[model samples]
Target: MSRRTDNRHRVATICRRATGLTHDTCLRWAADGLITRQRPVPDAGTPQQRAFEARLFAELAAGAVLGLTGIRPARAEPALALHADRAREVLDALLPRLDGTGALRGVPGLRLVPDGGSWWLTDLVDRVARVRLLHPRPGWGPRPGPTARQDGGRDPLWRTHRHALHPAEAALLYGRAKEDGASWDRDLLFSRTLRRLRLIVDAGAQHGWVRLDTTGAYDLVIECCCASGALKLMHGLRQSALAQERDDEGPGYSGDIDVGGACVAVRHASCGSFPQPVAGPDLRWVTC
Candidate 1:
């Protein structure tokens, strides 16, 4: 066996050699509470911590050599589940609040369900969830449709006023988008909706109609508009107070507002939209 030059060579050197990541990166990870390091007590230390450090080093080194950092991105599995559970709870608390005269009062007649699939109803649920996350109360409205004419003609009425679109109108818009080849991928769709939701919250807060609270939920106050002909749309939103915090604590918001009117219908027309609101038998009418 070769002679060991020093104890440092055995531990720190081995760690650096095994991980392929820079010594600083390893140390940073350790400092950030991501990885733990062990030091022998003059002669002995915890074997578990030592093993973990060695394994992490080795994995990093291997990743470097293969140009494949085996480290998976951090995820919030437990937090996500918790958020989903909380979403269900919040939904339960919200439906009753929708009963009286207001934007939500029209939901019963629209056959709203808990499922995130119906266009108008899902929009409503999403708006509520968003408000709950941003302020104490939640609200959302239809996104404006394309101003330019498409090859088929002006976009459908539903596309222009999804919030106001009837079932028949939604069906027509869905067919049109499918025909035009404008639908996006799941990841893209989620990202777009998230951005749009933020903008809506900001606009409402600025107008003094809503307030985005510390928990990311909103406090909403609906005002009656005399414009009876204006189309109304609802949004279905999901917020996770337990998951992550907003990046900044500024009074302003950033990001694009182009949440594609074309793709919104795909979410609006599905079955998941309505059933997501009511719990049991109360769901019958909404589902129908």
Candidate 2:
């Protein structure tokens, strides 16, 4: 095993060995909030804490490697069995957002293992037992494979997730360099989006659906702009709390904004050049 004094390299060693990633890619993932650590701060954490981070990263990265190759990474059966119930609960809560994507409807349940790179939504179960959905690469674009781009492009919801990615995020997720445009204004758009994603993820132990946490960190980002279109909307949003809107499709929750006493569903469109805020049946709202 390679050893390093630098904290980035120390963690990178685990990530690299696990997924054959370059040290720089691992560093970028850390900077981008892609792979969260137990004690995520730099040299400030203890060696034992650091070691734990490495192990966790290794597992996550290893699973990601499997996913990149179009394989659904699974946890050891015993380990998966313990958290089976929790997995199903979380999945139940998340399915409506995934309605149109067709990625999770077939999912019967999930496992506690590394759901891969972003911890997006790889854990899943089918009729027989728990299976995993292949985690996408870090990009808002498609995974690197024959069908990745075609599959991703065809789905409007998938495109909306892509819209959420900033150029910087795109770079890190795709193993590329940070993009730099010739002029400041040209780069502004990407910078602003990246800032938003960074801010949202940093405030979390749960960085949106990228990782699941108890605090419901994803609740905000997934909500559509229509629900909070204006200052008036925010004031209205204060009137009520996010509640589960369950139906025959599945059990799921959303924060609906009261518009003239009419609750408007916050269905953030996952596709199209302009994502509109109107009531629709349901679309799986996975993160970009």
Candidate 3:
């Protein structure tokens, strides 16, 4: 039927067509700001119904904009396109250097490292890409804690930890050189990197393998956050370097280890209201 000929029919049709909303539901949505009326209703019969239908269509449009609509487009292309391209470039450059056994036996700038008896860059590129696609936000919620730790004075291991990235991730996000200036690309990279680091921390905590303690000579310690477990290995390397320095310089070098490079901060919070779930390992052994 021609919409102009029957106003009620037109209104009902648009309401149902746009949002699959009933006439009454459309009216509620309109009142709730979920939708808006297209035009002023006539001062006659069915005015309320006409207003309701207009609002329904508006709500439906809003739904589409907020990605709440069922008919939204697939996210593969628009969300992760750039990330996928960069990952491909990094892999292409690094993969060729692997030995005949698919091991990074001899590669410059990139080396094959081991973690949990496995070999992988912890698939960091993929981790960064996935995090960017899912959460393009500035910060993450608090990490979860054990149910027993809900009350005060829980062990430090049950606390939530927050961390910022190191130079490599920051460089990718803010651009290799500062003079290149800010752009959407840099913003996306920075946001993605933050999200990825949070995820990495969470995953490590869940496995009960990650530890953050400053009691040792080092000011900050990060264990098991790298792709090849390089973070842990790096800690050993630093200790070795310090030992060598001490041996060469004698007892005069009785100073604090200057490991004050950037590290994720771990702090205790009440477990009852933690913002997110904590998965993986039990970290109770590592005192904060």
**Whole-model lDDT, candidate 2?**
0.28
lDDT of 2 by residue, 137-157 (tens): 242322444443233343222
Clashing pairs in 3: 121-227, 122-227, 206-279, 206-280, 206-281, 207-280, 207-281, 208-281, 208-282
Model 2 segments beyond 4 Å from truth?
1-5, 30-106, 109-288
lDDT of 3 at 243: 25
**What's the best-to-worst order under TM-score?**
1, 2, 3
Best by TM-score: 1
Q: How close is candidate 1 to the true structure, as a TM-score?
A: 0.19
Alpha-carbon deviation at 180 in model 2, angstroms = 53
lDDT of 1 by residue, 159-241 (tens): 33445554543554366447743333322333222222322222222111221111122111111111110011121111111
Q: For model 3, what is the C-alpha lDDT against the true structure?
A: 0.28
Per-candidate Cα lDDT values, in order, are 0.24, 0.28, 0.28
Compare candidates 1 and 2 on lDDT and give the better one.
Answer: 2
Off by over 4 Å in 1: 1-111, 114-174, 185-191, 207-288
